[model samples]
Structure formats: structure tokens, C-alpha cells
Target: MHIRRICESEGDAAGTLWDHMCRETGDGRPLTERARRDVSRMLAASAWHRDAFCLVAVHPGGRLAGFVNGRISTGDGLLPGLLGEIEALYVVPGDRGQGAGRALARAATDWLVAQGARTVRYLSCAGAHDDHRFWRSLGFEADMVCLSLYREP
Candidate 1:
């Protein structure tokens, strides 16, 4: 298996992967009406591309097995100058246990660290739902918990 960072040339592939991730999510909210406006604004963004990163894992036959996306920021002061937080991660069911997820994660985290991130945070909400064991096996420990309070508009 091979893992690598995504580039502009792979926009379609990345978009497809993102679509798959969204579809796999149980969340019911559709894309927001404001998303178009957000995209217009994001088109003018320079740091968005620089701060954001993605890693993709390919199977032996060159099929995309999984991917990870995240950004390195100053939030939480976990690392040094930048803290890496994983925003999304997904692996096809058939690809599980083959190290695709791990390879993707390692690539993303390595890039963040190379960019001077002192801390890496993997946001596993709902207390690790299904892959807690996988993360624990990777040597990650929970140092803090985030609680959310939402109000219906």
C-alpha cells in the first residue's frame, strides 16, 4: 500500500472521497444553503489550502482505500507552533484491518509535524464509537474531553 498527500491535480478524486465520507455519515443534515456563499468566499482564501492537508491510502491495485483530512492550527497548544487536528477519516469496510487508515493517518500527522506542529489531536467524538481499539493501539491517549451544547434554530 502507498500513502501520499493530495494535490490540486487530484481535486476530483478528493471531492469523490469527500462525497463518500459524507454519504457514509449517519448525520442527516443536508448541505447548508450557505454552502455556496461559503465556497465563493473560500475561493479567495489563501491560507485555507496552506493550512489544510489530506492524505490518501491506495491499495495494491491502486484503488483508494481510505483518507484523512485535518489542519494544523494554534488551537489548544498541544504541539509547538501548530497543533494538528484530524477533521475526518474514513476507510472502506472491506479495507479495514489492512492498515489503510493507519497509513493515511501517519501521512497526515507526519506532514503536520514537518510543518512544525507540536501536538496532534485526533477528534474522536462519542468516545471512539467503533474504532477505539485501533486508535488505542496507535498509542494515543485521551487528555481532554470536549462537550457540546447545541440549540435548535
Candidate 2:
């Protein structure tokens, strides 16, 4: 798999992958139209932002196998210096374990480091054993756990 920065023309393809990620990891609800638009806007912004990026892993046949979006920002009051976050990462089911995910993550991390990030972090889905193991293998340790409560209107 070849990894590179995502191009402007590939926005739709990235959106499709984002939907797949949401479906696979989310609470079984499809993304609302507003949510989809919001993601599209975010992706567009990443492409133009110096401190943010989206990288895509392409199959030999020119298909996108996966993508990872990351950004650099000031850490919360507790942590000092700039922080790098792997905002989202998703690989097509068929492409899993073929190094696309790792390559994407590596590329993003490298970019973040180049941009002066002091530390890199990512949030994995709770109870996602495989996902946890994958990040751990990459030397990422659990720094914190986030809990949320949602109520239907």
C-alpha cells in the first residue's frame, strides 16, 4: 500500500470511508446529514491547515484502503507544549492487517512530530480489544479514559 496526503479530488471517497468507520464503531446509527456535512467541512479544513492533515493509504489498484486524520494543538492546562492527536483512523475491512493502518498512523505521527508536537495521543473505542492492542503495539500507552452519557430527546 502507498500512503500519501489526501488530495482535494478525493473528498467523496474519504467521506465514504468516514461513514464506514462511524457505522463500524458507533452506536449502530447512521450519520445524520448534518453530521456528514460537519465531517466534510473538517476534512476540507485539514487539507488547508498547516497544523492538521489527512493521509490516505492507497491500494495498488488506486483504491483508498484507509485514512488517518491528525492535528496539533495546545494541550489542556495540565499538559504542557503542543499535543498531537490522531483524531480518526479507519481501514477498510478487507485491508486490515495488511500494514495500511500502520503506515497511515506512522505517516501522521511523523508529520505531527515534524510540526513540533511534544506528545502524540489517540482515543480508542471502549472495549475494543484489538484496537487497543494495535495502538499499544505502536508504543501508545493508555493515558486516560473518557466516559460519556447520552440521553435521547
Candidate 3:
């Protein structure tokens, strides 16, 4: 398996994989809405590809097994400098537990470090997810916890 930057030709497969990730942690939202939102975000990233990064893992037979996205930012008012963030990561069920995820993450984080990021951040999806442990295994420690309450009136 090889990990590398995303290419234009893989757009459709990558989009599908991204929508799948959204659905997994999206708390039952409709797929159409998810696709809409993912596409918009992807277009924005594609618009300024120099400032953001996306990586994909390919299986031996040339299928896209998983993908990750990240960006280095010239921080917001509070942070005040360049910061690296692991924006999104997902691996197909068939490819999990075999180090593909780790390799993708390492490539992104290493790139961030090379870009002079002193601080890198990542937020796992919803409650008590198993991937939290996966992030920890990569030497990442939780810096904060966020809680939310959703209601309908």
C-alpha cells in the first residue's frame, strides 16, 4: 500500500469515502445533505490546494481504501501563528487495523512539522468513539473536551 497526496482523477472515490466518514459520525443525518456539505467543503479546499492537503491509501489492486485531509493555518485571533490540524481521517472497514491509518497520519503530521508548526491539533468524532484510542496510540493526548446539548422545541 502507498500513501500519497490526492490526485484530481480520484475525486469521485474520495468524495464517496468522505461522505461515508460523515455518515459514520454524523448522528443519522441524511446522505444527500451530507454529500452536499462535503462537496462544498471539498470545493473550497480544491480552490486553494496549496494551503491544504489530502492523502489517500491505495490497495494492492488499485482501490482507494481510505483518505485523510489536513491544513496549516495562519492562526485565528486567539492562537496568533501557524497551526497544523488533522482535519479528517477515515479508513474503510476492510482496511482497518493494518497500519494504513497510522501511516497516513504520520505523513500529514510530518508534513505539518516540516512546515514549522509548533502545535498540531485533531478532534475525534462523537462520543466514546474507538478512534480516540487510535489517536492516542499515535502519541496524541487530549488537550480539551467539548460537550454539546441538542434539542428541538
RMSD of each: 4.0, 1.9, 2.9
State TM-scores per candidate.
0.75, 0.89, 0.82
Q: lDDT for model 3, please.
A: 0.78
> Model 2, 1-153: lDDT tens per residue?
799888776767787789888888647556787877777667766767788899999988889999999889897846777899999999999999788889998999999888988899998778889889989988899988899999999
Of the two candidates 1 and 2, the one with more favorable TM-score, higher being better, is: 2
**Best candidate (score: TM-score):** 2
Candidate 1 RMSD to the real structure: 4.0
**For candidate 1, what is the TM-score?**
0.75
What tens-digit string does per-residue lDDT give for candidate 3 at 39-149?
646734643487688888898788988888888887773675679899888899889989889999998898788877777889875665677888888888888878889
Quick one: ranking by TM-score, best first?
2, 3, 1
lDDT of each: 0.67, 0.85, 0.78
lDDT of 1 at 23: 63
Query: What ranking emerges by lDDT with the best candidate at the front?
Result: 2, 3, 1
Candidate 1 stretches with Cα past 4 Å from truth are: 28-48, 60-62, 76-80
lDDT score of residue 9 within candidate 1:
51
